[model samples]
Target chain A: MVLIGINEFIYVASILFLIGLLGVLLRRNTIVIFMSIELMLNAINLALVAFSRFNNSMDGSIFVFFIMTVAAAEVALGLAIIVMLYRQRQTILVNELKQLNG
Target chain B: MIDILFSIFASLVLLSALAVVLNRNAVNSAMFMIVSLVATAGLFILLEAYFLAILQILVYAGAVMVLFLFIIMLLDVDKGENFNFKTRKLSLCATILGVLLLLALILNSFSSNNLPSVELFLIEDSSFIDPGAFDNKAKAFGQLLFTKYMLPFQVIGFLLLVAMIGVIVISKKPKF
Candidate 1:
């Protein structure tokens, strides 16, 4: 049961992370990609808290808090950028935004 | 019992995640993302990190994702049919890499000999364990955040403030 505990949590976290990665890679819409990124962050948070619990320490939870803070800020800035891009191009398709390619 | 619950929550998280990715509309994707976040929060609770679980729901599912929905509604984007899952060569490569990574993680996890037992972490003190036991999680988390992790906590606050200012500066319409 001891080994199973760690294996279980790690398995869940890895699967979540993989799903998020697939979403990021395959999704065409910019907003969906952003959502996938959020999924990735949550997966890492799950892993962190799981490790912290396994070790009986509070440090991992603290790190999760900080990660959450950063994620919040990231969403704010990222969405603002998306809004601006929408205003300029009138489309949120990832492949169409090529103005910065020059 | 825990395994059953874990399986339920894991499937919910994964299925909602897939919906978020495969949904055609941006709004639907955001909604599915919120569901995935909430299910992930449930997993956090099962991990015994009650404080992180609450924060997960409040921050991710509540505030941040709400903002995503607000923006989606504000933009009033057409229900465009742009969602595509067509696999290219790169996707196949990514899939192969993902499978290899999963195999490596599982094998490596098995090789590790010092994995701690769940019983070791289970709350044994019935006196300290009650319906309100998790209520202390936030207080304990706060104490640590303010003491040992004070510098990093403050730094995160500052970072958030800076990001807020940057968003305003970037998004504000020019008057002149």
Candidate 2:
């Protein structure tokens, strides 16, 4: 019964992470990939909070705070870049942005 | 009880994440991503980190995802054909790598001695029955952020400010 604790959360996080990884690997849309990355971050946050609760330590929660801050920052920058790319190419397809491949 | 709830949310999160990736329309992907984020936040609540779970909903699902959707809406990306990898070999390699990583993670988890164990903190003189009501987690978090992690916190704030400025500069039309 007690086994339904932190390990369960870890399993959930791992599944989310795997899904995100597959999204990043298989998706061609830049926006979708970015969303997957956000998913990955959320998965990590779940693990952090779960461990924090199980260990009775506040540090993991604190880490989640910082992670959220960084994730917000990342979203801002990432969207800005995506917007710029869309302006230049008129499409958000990851495969279409091969101008830098030279 | 907890396991059942956890499994349900986990499946929902994973499914939404897959939909986000597989959906052809960028806006639809963003919407599914929002769903996934919300489900992840629910899982966080189940983990007893109520403060974090609320923050997750507020920040990621609410603020960040909205920002993403706004950008997608503003961009008006054409419904182009989905991009497929040029070489099947590359995708095959990626799949193999993914499977190997998954296998390793499961094996490592089983082999580790750090299996999950709950530690009960001794709460003296606190008669609060609702853990959510007595939750000083956010307060304690703020204190630590301001004291020990203050510099890093300020750095991140400054970085966000810079990013905002950069976006403005980039998006502005030339006056000339």
Candidate 3:
């Protein structure tokens, strides 16, 4: 009998967030790290939606709408940057992306 | 019934989230992320946020994820053979940190729901809404967004315009 509560949702959000953090830290590839960042943002979205439910307000829901918009913009820009990086460096690994130091 | 729906979707979200991290291939990770996002939208529906649930499916699972797949295939980015790692220390640390964070969140959730924000919203709403009236949530949010949040909304539009220009300018190939 899995009794789901608001706390269950919170716990799920926290675990997903930690997974995102580890993914960012452990993965060396820039694409993988970028995916991890998206995962973290999704976790935030989950928490916001859950809080909006319990708090009985439209504010958090509206906030999530804006967050979604910002996320779309971020993906567009980030993918462009990734494409440019690959063209310039011939690789997408984060460990090898220090061309700015020159 | 709701609890069952939540459990199923939540499990799907967790499994796909783990897959996004553990998969060696970036393409596979992106695919898994789409699954995770879809399940997240399902959870939003359970929470009765209909508009957000639909937006999550449309924007995140549809548009954004397709963009991810496009970039991945276009870039031809793949992981190399140097993939193995010493999981002993890192996994242990991550497990400990995760457990601690979950514990803190669980404890906080179990306590009373007397949060200031909750209280404030209750006062503003002034009465318990009928379950049939949940659709009104979207209406209220739309109204507030257009009125009180209008300025920020306009700013975000401008920000998106700027970001578009910046990306094109930055990614443009410089001629020698």
The best-first sequence of candidates by TM-score reads 1, 2, 3
Question: Candidate 3 on A14-72: residue-level lDDT in tens?
Answer: 88898898887677777778888988989999998777777665677778888988988
TM-score of chain B of 2: 0.80
Please write out the lDDT profile of model 3 over residues B74-114, one tens digit for every residue. 87777452672224677577668777877777777667762
Clashing pairs in 1: none
DockQ scores of the candidates:
0.55, 0.56, 0.50
Ranking according to lDDT, highest score first: 1, 3, 2
Candidates 1 and 2 compared by TM-score, better number? 1
Instruction: Give the residue spans of candidate 1 off by over 4 A.
Output: A1-4, B78-87, B106-118, B124-136
Task: Please identify model 2 stretches exceeding 4 Å from their true place.
Answer: B83-86, B109-116, B119-136
TM-score per candidate, chains pooled: 0.87, 0.87, 0.84
Could you tell me the TM-score of candidate 3?
A: 0.84
Q: How far is candidate 2 from the true structure (C-alpha RMSD, Å)?
A: 3.6
Clashes of each: 0, 0, 0
